[model samples]
Target: MSDGRLPTRRRTVGWIVAVIVMLLLFAIGWVMVRGFGALSELQNVRHSVAQLHKAIDERAVDRADRIAPRIAQHTELAGDLTSDPIWRGFEFVPWLGQNFTAIREIAAIAGDAVDDAVTPIVALAADVDLTTLGLSGSRIDLVPLPKLADPLSGAASALAAADARARLIDLDGTLSLIADAVGETRSMIEDAASTVGALHGAATLLPGMLGSSEPRTYVIAVQNNAELRSHGGAAAAFIQVSAAGGTISVVRAASGLDVPALTEPLELDDAVLVLYGDGPWRIPRDMTSVPDFAAAGSLIAQRWQSQFGTAVDGVIAVDIDTMRHVLTATDAVQFDAFTATSDSITTVLTNDMPQAIPDPAAQDIAFSRAAQAVLGAALSSEEPSSLLAALSDAARDDRIRIWSAHEEEQDLLAASSLGGALPHDDDHDVHVGVLLNDRTGAPLDAYAAATITTAFGVCDGTPATQIRVTWTSAVPEEVAASAVAPEGGAPGDLRTLIAIYGPQGASARGGLTTTLDRRPVVQQDITIAPGESGTATATFTGAGSSDPLTRLHHTPMLEDPEILRADIDCG
Candidate 1:
């Protein structure tokens, strides 16, 4: 009985062992299948990545092929304009002559290139199906065959899911990079197109005006009055010649005035000269009524004697209001679209009115609205031919008060009175000679003053001095010295030293008083040749200092007017 029981127990143990072995084998087989599947999936993912890279490279090549020719053409056109002789003499002409057709072609080509490059990228960005790209059944072979049936199998599955998520994230990043490239390309193309279009438009009109046959010459006479000593007591006389065939020549004539200190007068050999001065003088608001303002105009004529050989052919004087009206009429004011503060826009708009518009806020808003309307109209217009005309008409109809005197008026009166006092031959050039004579019949000692107001209507605080009495001679050297005042308080005072303020100021003092300092100062000076009259000048220097009075101080006031007293004629 004992032997039979032992044999049965052994058989039961053998059966238990056999069942455990079969279970182990089955687990191992399942793990091998999953491992192989994961390897195949990884290989497929790698192939997709390669294909994406290849597509990117192909797109880049295709874009380059389309863009290179346009870029080359643009470069070539720029180079041609820069080197062209007709354009070089006057830069605006070549700019105006720029081929709009070529520019448009380049812009179109660039636009097309950008569009083509972005098309595929945009598609790829939109085509991605995030759900499909996720790996629900994907697995990684992290567990050994023996450990396939471990309780941590759930953790291993989670790791595999994490790896699949990582791959999808990588694909998303690649797509994002492609999308950015496409966007950059599109932006670049747009910018290029805008730049080209602007260049083309600017060039078109600039050259014609610059090279026009109309004479661009201007002659100005400046005076200084010692009594009304503000900005060197200066006044300005300007003559602009717009006629096609008019000839202007300035000669240095000898008149009784000092030479060495005054230097030589600049001879305007067919060139336009603009002169400005200060004085206790009057200017007529209307040129048609010359007699009404003759006394004031006489002062202008007197000032011209020092700088010009004769009376200028034409004169047109427009004050601050007129200037503002012209600018506004031309629609030249511009505003920044981005980052332009309301305060800044308001300031510009309000400050540019004819007489400081009563309600500044309302005026600024109105101006802005009007400007918008005009701009909108211009943009909407099918043809821009009338744009400039409209602007000019606005300026003309703005009722800007101006003073004008022309040679034609003077010539007509002279012709009617003289009948034949002046030669009538058309070929003979008309000369407007100015003769300087003192009341006592002695050499005249002329005192003059010139001033320059900058684009922003700021006057320089310095005064130029031309002293001594002798004959008027062409002294070109005096131009610089006469344009600005000496650094020292007195130009002739031997003891008075001229000092220059530098970027780092340990003032530089010089013994030479006649030499101009050219520093930023509102110049005012009284030139007295012992008992003779002299000239003064003021220039606007847009410089600022820490002192409030000196901060951006552009207006130079003439402090003394007794230098030009009628009873104190030096002659």
Candidate 2:
């Protein structure tokens, strides 16, 4: 009777074990199905959002309007899948627990971004007549644009929150591939947030800057980067432009050389005196030497006033490449020796025109004529949106910069990258600056290229950092000699004062030309004949950081802007 009872207990235990196994299998199957469904929905959300962005970029209002609702729907679906009951059942499951948590986090991030930025953006899009805005002339109506400020501001706030949330996410360990995808989604959200922030700022500021109140006067200094300098390049030419009642007019135009010398002694900074000497101030002829645009613009305004007896409200500086970008809106203009089209204007102005007339005095004539022709064609352009787009593109590339004496106007420009001021940032973990002041008188920088690298670490309980700056000229030895001189100076010899602004509180130690006001300067002399690369390195003790972000604020040189970012781990 006892043996029979034991067999009965064993049979009962077997039935219980089989039931538990069956339930586990069912739960696993449900998790897998739910996870895959969430993933699919997330992918759909991504696709829909991408399509919406494309529609907005292409100004396809109807398509964007249609896609916006779909984006919201897909995002909501993704959120539902991530927060499904299956995830709750799998919360205690090994490996899948982390994945489920990450998925939910990603879904929430996406949904929040869509709600914060996309919702307001779509609503704003619906309210505005994009096609009409695009087709309008150079002048934009500021009255209706101010109404967009609230929505844009809301979108900006949402994006800021998204970016902050993204930084807090730990998308690693089990199911890291999915985690990586989630990380990418966070990056996209950050980018969208930045766009919305910019739109918000523009909405809030554009009305006043575009002459909603009174007329504004600006001096446009056209920099020829062939003779690259700190701020941009030598102001090769300048145009006085005015905006009144939302209309822009070219008041006057002349070569930089045409602006007469300043008689009075101009106050100068130590950096300007050390790098440029008394040339820019005494003569007001060379605007390139001073890296500070505010200072340079002040001097330029003085000269402008001296010449024209009219005060300028601000100064806008742009290089030759930016001019070519502006020309994209217009048809080609026939110059003396060649046609000035958007594609050819840079070459014609920098190479062909320079080479055609070697006389320094005669160069301005060509530049003035080319400038006038390009400006006329650009202003007369029927595609005002295209012109603005081209200008915006150039501005993003750092080819265009603006400095305003008016505090109110400058407040707006200061918030933008176009504000050509050396950043006084202390909150950043690391600040690295590579400022090049061309020693070569010619447009040799057009052929010169640079590479910058920084290594950081902690040693003996103190931070240590090292910066390496390498410069090379691609100009052939034979042609380099001829290309060396610009205006009137040494030929083939590329002499540059490379100022390396190291991390804050870090002293530069090594072979340095001179240390002026904490900035270590390295003088590089590269002749066209050698084709050899010049290298400069400086080690700074006590500059290491726990946070390994390396921020580079450099004078825009001839390099892909993306390639200049050097972010590496700190030891």
Candidate 3:
């Protein structure tokens, strides 16, 4: 045992053990170095991507082109650094393994999102004169749309595949730091996918809907926010518009009151009938109170055909919020009494003009004029792209909804936010929904204020969720309640239909109200007086979500709603 010189076999074994340890140490050292490099590369990729977005947003195509290669380089480097045999081997270490695997997979997805999905779309956008791509004043260009279908579809598919992959990654079990990173990554990918998917849908659907192939007609409902409805507000006026090739002209305009109630109501989903009752089925103005824009569009279309014997190709509904958004991109629109900018458009439409022009017929004419003036301003806007951006923004906020009558195109529309169809697809986010519908028969909703918040029962990993709405009637005592009294309403009284949709597949138990789309929905009717307040809350027992955040998919109001959460015990 003490001999300085050993036997040949023992010496060979000693040499083998020494070499193995050296290799192991070298492998560990290599991984450590690569890890640092990969992190740096990823950081560079993030920075480059941000720069790329800025360039794209600024419409600096040349700058975006120059930035592309940097992103590609870093994404490739990050992927290569994380996917080597050594790195892959570390992914077998149980919980530790998932972190490594998630990192590696996210790196690949990042590469795919930028290089394959975003770059192609950006390139496609650059290939065309985007300044006039969507709308220029009153005209819509359909000439360049068909060419975008294939590439846009491919980009959407790639991003959608990437999003699906990201959603499958379990973040709850991962380290907090890594989980946050992954969640952010997932959100970015999802947003990209939704945007590209919508673009793809537009490219495929707009041709026919815009009457590129043949003449078409559509009904446009501009909602009046003074009288609130589920989709936005009471339909104030309707415009029958016809399109051929690229030009759209107003065929006719009619007040919502002109159309008589349906002697026979359009068939509604039993759930809708139970909750909305016969109000929607009875009155033309209340037809839009149904939340499903697709259904509401169809109902309006049917009502129009019955009343005017006109068959329309599609339907569009917009509120003052949409107009207010577009005013930011267009020139100031002049009303009878004042100039309306983005900040004052809502008041000008719903409050000032109606109060200034008290004659019902005269007020309707002014309403129609104001709408057309806004359109004329938008068509002549110096920055046409800005109008498109505004419209996209409004659509995302649920202030504008379009529904196609064509079967092929409608399928795509029903699946996207472009149509404002109530979510039919199963989603992962915890959903809390609230709807504020005016029943006071007055324009007093414009003077109302509401605060919506989320509450948890016990906060010990609470499964029960509560949605609280504290609504206040802010109408002043001196102001007239309404110019044209469609029905009797007190200036001091605010009556509303408030519905709180709990989490998906959850029940309110004792708080059970009604069911919509086979999902539990709680609703209540309340009346509040001026300077007074009312509160509505719904508690659902089975509400749960893997996501730390809850999604409040409520009706878009005149004021941007803030969704707040309160934890009873954990706070």
Candidate 4:
């Protein structure tokens, strides 16, 4: 009886152990199945994203609309699979649960995007003809502009929501599965959102900005970077353009030479007045010494008002490179003097204009004529996409900077790189400026190139930043001798005012030197002979900025400055 009892008890214990092991195995299998299901759903969502993007690219709105809804469906399915409290609770289960959390978060964000972004974007694509916004024709079609505002607003909302969610993603763990996908989606979404927002704001403001209610006048300052100035090159020429009721026309074109002398004594910014001496009040060159374009813009508007007895609503600064971009888009433009094509526009405008025209005064005439002809062609051009692409390229290269006097319009521009305002250092980015203000009073800067080198070190428990700017004059001696200068200035002297800006909160000190003089000083008038070079060095301490990255801000010059990053021996 004792043996029989022992055997029965042993069998019961073995059965109980077998049941517990089976339960553990089942739990593991469930989690595995749940995680895999979530991954599969995520792949479906990604597939939908790809399809939608393809539809948008092809401008197949119906396809996009169909694909858009599927994203929401797949995201919901994935969301439900992972959002179950039991599955979510597995998040603490080490390596197995990370993918679940990632899919959950991504699905949630993607769901918000589908609701706020996808439908509206499809609507935008269907309703608006993108080429019309290029201002390709003489008159802007204002009808679709208003229609775009809603979808654009929705897209922006979706992007903001997605970005907020993306920020919360644990990139080190769960998101490793779709890191590139997540990153690319976020980047593309942010960029598209910004573009849409800008377009929406512009659409809302453009009718009035273009003087839909009444006629508005604007001064288009043509900056020539041949002689590098604070804002591109000298505003060597000015074109007065007017718009009324969505129709734009070039009213008149004038060289900076013809700007009427300032009759009314004007109140000018001290920096402008100090750096650029009291010269004939020409708006084109007036801003060459100042960095803040808004200030220059105001001065330009004021000067235009003073000279022409009419107030300008805004200032648009375009450079020779921008003209070339337009020419490229239009293929080529022809005037009585010559054809302005992309291939030859830069050289013809900068190098050959004076020689071909053989008259310094008429060189401005040739330049203006070529520019006006290009403008005329663009206004009449049938290819809106090409023209818009050209303008986009120019703006990206900092060749097109603008400032509007209208508060609303300027506010819109402030959100754009084309606003031409110095960036505020709220994020404590290491800001170092190596700017050249041409004092040679000539276009000799065409031959000048700059090299800026920076290194980082720690000093007394804080980061120390050092900068050096080397200016080289590659002008041939003959070219230097023949260079044209502002009426009263010498031709051969490549005099430049080197304004060095350091990081905010950092105490800075530096000076200039030249190959001619081996000694460096705290400050000196910078003068480089033709075919020579000069250097400026500055050191900054106490910036308290921990960011190792540095950014240099300067006016876009003819020759792109060479940038070098070097490590400091922290010893």
Candidate 5:
């Protein structure tokens, strides 16, 4: 019995040892399963990363290739605008306008391409699928194992990692290319936009020059002792136009006609007439020197007033170079031909017509010989009118020639036509005054007003400030007699006064007693430093005028010109 019991006990012990071994084996198997599962999941994550990298690289390369051509085109377009001769010629004509559409289109395309390339990548990143790759949860489920583990899993993971790194490198390179391309495209667009903007600004003035119903006339009145060619003395030409009647005339003032004394009123039928001449005639460069130009212009204006009983509204002067460039650029004549013809015409006009070009023979001879020959080859047609027409046509194109002389005329024309007029008074009278002063009350200089207009409104009456005064003429028929000042001295003495007059006797006044546009004048005090300037404004309403000139006449009067002195010391 004892022996049997001992054998049984040993068997029991062996069974216990077998159970312990089985438990150890099971633990090892479980550990292996979990380790493999985690590894597989990491491999899957890496695979997704590799795929994403590849997509990013491919898209970047595609985008760069797509935008490269457009970038090149935009660069070329920008270059052409600055360098192309045809474009330069086109600038002379205002109507051709600017070519901004092409630039805008290219910008739009580049913007769109960037959007398209980035959108898909962003979407793919946001909506990546992990469930299909058996990565639904954070922990791996060991119960759902495939019959055979993917033998290529490790190899695939290694390949994926390598591919991903390569793709990232490629992506980096492609992005750099894209950045360069975009930069080039943007630079080109900006250049084109700026050029187009300038062109547009210049072209905006054409309509005013061409579309005015009034006769656009210019009077070339010589103010100097320059020689004339027609009769061998001083020469001048009065270019006149009647838009309503479709009549144009060029009159030659008789030699020895006192240019300053010829301030006679001449009838211009609803026309914009500018009196100008060839001379170093003084013109005010700015408010500081306006008086000099204004005084000189005033003399000319007085001549018109003496002759026609009304002052001229506008005045301009041109040099010999100006005339040459205008004619040359418009006709597209070669430089040599333009120089010759211009010289000849200048000689004839300066030596002969010491007064004006009133003779038909002179006009015919001048136009037929030198002028026609210079213009003939330039125009498609041989008619003198055609040459003028060609010039007009060229002015409408967007081609700006860089000739300094022509640029001056263009600036002058733009100013005269578009810039508002200076202040004036009824009876076609205008007073333009400018004062320059140091920080103290001492006056340094004074200038004639080059521009005066009611458009500037009122004076704020701030000390040391420069003020502009304008007046409009009054027409007796337009306003009631009661509104008139009774032709005597003003009714009241006021610190500030403004009077407006218009065609047909329309008039209004403003001060402490009179109101502006029915609104009482508000006076405010402002302090100015010794070297600083300030302005005071007073406005008057309820005045009527037939034209801008007439309205200026009815505006107001500046009582103390010294009060509006400019601060010169501030500079």
Candidate 6:
């Protein structure tokens, strides 16, 4: 009887084990199906969203309108597929759950972003004729701008939240491929958030500043790469522009030397004063020497008002590279005394003009002519949207710095890369700055290039680091005597004002023409003979954080400077 009972129990146990195995297999198979479907939908969402962006950028409203709905549909489907009971249950599995959780959350975030941001932004984009906003014939229709402000702001906020949620997804313990996909998703969300936020900032500020309601005066200072300043270079020319009721025109043009120095220094930030002193404040040409465009812009505005009696609402600074972009966009641009297409503008402005017209003051007038020509062409360009895109690219490269006397507008500008403000310690990354000013007082920098590198050290925590800058002067000694000597600098030699701002709270010890500087900011006056090289170093201590990301910031150089970061000196 006992043997019979034991045999029955064994058979029952076998049946129960077989049933459990089948159920487990079915659940796994169903989860796989759901995952692949969700993946397909998510892929569709990405494609639609990408196409929608391209359409909006190209101002193809009809195409964007068609693509916009597809994004929302795919996003919703992906979210639903990922959130189903079987898939959601698998998200709790101990070892492999991180990947599941990440995918589910990413789908949800995408869906929410579509609902909260993409739909409304697309609708608003359709309402605005972007070409009209792109400065058509020296005029822009500002009416659509104000209407766009709110929706763009809302979209920016939604995407910002999506960015935050995406970053929080844990990729640890996930499959390698899943982790890579999730990381890329996070990066894309982050980039979208940043870009939209900048656009929102622009929308909020541009209308009022461009004189939608009242007349406004703006000073556009064209910085020359010839004589590099901390922010870019000395303002070689000034174009005074006036705008009212969506129409704008150049009011006047002047050389940077045309504006006389201030009789008395305007107020300065203690840090700024400590570094550059009254130089940037007193000499309108030297305004950019301070590296803080806000301060530089304010002083220039004051100087222009004092000189010409027109109070500027804002100051915009552009370099030769930026103007080249503008000229490229406005293909029919014509210049006098020298031929300059976008391809030849850099040579025309920096090298050819200096050689052709040697007098510093006269050279400046010629540069001013070039600036005026580009502005005129841009204002009347047939493809103003292309001009707008070019200017936007220049801004992204930090080649354009803007300042507004209006406090509210200035606040927004200060928060962006183009503001040219020194970053504080508490900003996202550990920051180090290398500012270069050509003390040669000539367009010598156009003939030179800079190479900058930061050597990160490891202390106990966030290690203090050192920034090394080497300036190479390519000017033929003969040309230096011919070109730079006229500006009262040593013939055949390059003199430079190198300002180094270390991590905000760090102390610095330095070498090679450096004077012991105030905490975190070091200043050096270096002279490199023509066809020679000069180097300087700023060593910092106590600059590290628990989690440190080092960022090197610099003024716009004639040739885009190369930046290198290396880990060294761990001991």
In the order shown, what is each candidate's alpha-carbon RMSD?
Answer: 33.8, 5.5, 5.8, 8.1, 30.3, 5.7
Q: RMSD in Å for candidate 1, one decimal?
A: 33.8
Off by over 4 Å in 6: 1-49, 57-59, 69-115, 131-134, 159-195, 268-270, 425-429, 460-462, 485-490, 509-519, 543-548
Tens-digit lDDT track for model 6 on 332-375? Answer: 45566787888998888888888888888898889899899888
Model 1 C-alpha lDDT per residue in residues 399-426, reported as the tens digit of each score: 1111224444333323321111211211
lDDT of 3 by residue, 1-571 (tens): 5668888999999999999999979977887787667667777777777787677767789988889888888879989999999899877877777877777888888888877776786697577644346666677788888998998888999988888777767654677766666677677777678767767777888788878989999998888777888888888778888888877788878777777677667776776776778778767788778877888888889889888999989999888888888899988898565789898888887678767876655666677667766766876787777887787778767788888799888888887776776564255445667877888776678888778887666434546667788888787776544422223445557888888877667766456777766457888888877788898887766546223455577777787666676653232
Q: Model 1 off-target regions past 4 Å?
A: 1-243, 246-291, 308-311, 329-571
Q: After superposition, how far is residue 359 of candidate 3 from its true place, in Å?
A: 5.8
**Candidate rank order under lDDT:** 6, 3, 2, 4, 5, 1
* lDDT string, candidate 2, 1-571, tens digits: 3554557788899999999999889878877787788777777877888888777767677898888778778778777876767677676677667778777777788888887778678767766743334225556777787788887888888887877676556554657667766777777786676566656766776666657798888888877776767766777788888887667789888886788666654776766676567777866547656765667777788778878899888888877787788778778887566788877787787677767887755776677667777777777788776776677667666787777777876776676566766654355335567777776666657767778777666545556566667777666565555654633334565666667766555555555555444555554434433365787666566443323455567776644432342443333
Q: Which candidate number would show the highest TM-score if scored against the true structure? A: 3
Residue 112 accuracy (lDDT) in model 3: 84
Candidate 4 on 1-571: residue-level lDDT in tens?
3544557788899999999999878866786787677667767776777787677656788888888888888777867777776667777778756655665677677667667877777777776655347365877866567767666766776676576556556545544555655555555445455555556665777788777778888898887777677778777678889988778899888876666556443555444444455541344465644566776787788877776888899888888888888887676777656766888887777776755665655766666677688788888778775776677668767777778888978886876677876655544334566657776766667778888777777656766776667888777766666776544445665777766666665665333322111111122247787778898666666653334556667668866799886664334
User: What lDDT does each candidate get?
Assistant: 0.27, 0.69, 0.76, 0.68, 0.29, 0.77
Model 5, range 121-232, lDDT digits (tens) per residue? 2333233321111112111222222211232223223333332222221111223433343334444333323322232332332223222334333333321112111111
**Model 1 TM:** 0.18
State which candidate, 1 or 2, has the greater TM-score: 2
Per-residue lDDT, model 3, residue 88, is 90
Candidate 1 lDDT score at position 164: 25
- What's the distance in Å from true for residue 184, model 5? 19
Which 10 consecutive positions of candidate 6 have the poorest summed lDDT?
510-519
Query: What TM-score would you give candidate 5 relative to the actual structure?
Result: 0.24
Write down the TM-score of every candidate.
Answer: 0.18, 0.79, 0.81, 0.73, 0.24, 0.79
lDDT minimum window of 10 residues, candidate 5: 440-449
